[model samples]
Target: MANAERRYSKDHEWVRVEGNEAYIGITEFAQDQLGDIVYVELPEVSSSVEKDEVVCAVESVKTAADIISPVSGTVIAINEELADQPEMINEDPYSAWIMQIELSDPTELGELMNAAEYATYCENEE
Candidate 1:
């Protein structure tokens, strides 16, 4: 696993950049709140995604939620492992990333909060 800086969004998504590509997944806090994950629908490879767009959908036992894109780019790859074992998400959200994207604007990362700020933001959520 590469070193991933936990930058986040108000929508409960996390973005971690490596080189010019970005890896994305929901936080552990989010998966825990959602309960057991049964399926994942990742964005098609090469599809363009805009920031805040619904890039994928995660289906838990109770509900299906969109995994919004935190930064815009072309989706280069997806985690095929999740399709076979969605519980991997429940076990480790960060490791079970939904997709990898080639960011259109790397600077967009500066706009997101760091781990501490994201934790504080989560606490302030309703």
Candidate 2:
């Protein structure tokens, strides 16, 4: 189930916005598809990313996948714990945020889907 407070992208990335900052991570569906996560390549803290850009990469036992940015912003922080425990994402993708960015354009959020819309989108894909 998608979190009501967060927005989702067609690429299966989720963004939880808090004021000017947005916490970014892959959706539960994404992690499930990837299988057991083995490693995560976290983006640099000060890096700038445009919407749809690859923020980082996640490697699972089955395959490796890029994590796209759902919003344009300067990455301000990352969940360093992922370095040692990448399985945290598979366990709880919502709480295991890969990065937090200072949103460069808040309006870009409008381009993303709400929880319900994303749920429908995922259904269509499946």
Candidate 3:
């Protein structure tokens, strides 16, 4: 499960909102499933993305996966540190956010699932 305050997407991304900007990353469960992360292809800073769109890509020992945006927004920042230490996400997915977005429609956050709800949803998916 993700941190209680973070919202989750069906695609396994997590969104931690702060004012109009939100940090986005794959959930711990997703990282665990991915095994060791090797590289990440982050969206260009200032790139506009729509909710549910593929905003980034993560490569792991097991497979490569697309990281979908949970909210429509412009990418304002990306974690450059991940380029040197992609495995950081495997160690701490929540703290190792991939990008920060300036929301185009903050109301899209309401469409996300809370921790408990996501946990249940994940369980049912398996």
User: What lDDT score belongs to each candidate, Candidate 1 first?
Assistant: 0.86, 0.92, 0.92
TM-score of each: 0.93, 0.97, 0.97
Model 2: residues >4 Å from true position, as ranges?
A: none
Candidate with better lDDT, 1 vs 2:
2
- For model 1 the TM-score comes to 0.93
Candidate 2 residue pairs in clash (backbone atoms < 3 Å): none
Per-residue lDDT tens digits for candidate 1, residues 1-126, read 212377888778888788999889888778988899998987899999999888779999899999888999999999999889999988888888889999999988988888888877777874
Greater TM-score among 2 and 3 belongs to: 2
Task: Summarize candidate 3's per-residue lDDT along 1-126 as a digit string, tens digits.
Answer: 468889999999999999999999999889988999999988899999999888789999879999989999899999999998999999999999999999999999999999999999889977
lDDT of 1: 0.86
Q: Indicate the worst ten consecutive residues by lDDT in candidate 1.
A: 1-10
TM-score between model 3 and native: 0.97
List where candidate 1 sits over 4 angstroms from the true fold: 1-4
The C-alpha RMSD of each candidate to the native structure, in angstroms, is 2.3, 0.7, 0.9
Measured with C-alpha atoms, the lDDT of residue 12 in candidate 2 is 94
The CA lDDT at 46 in model 1 is: 97
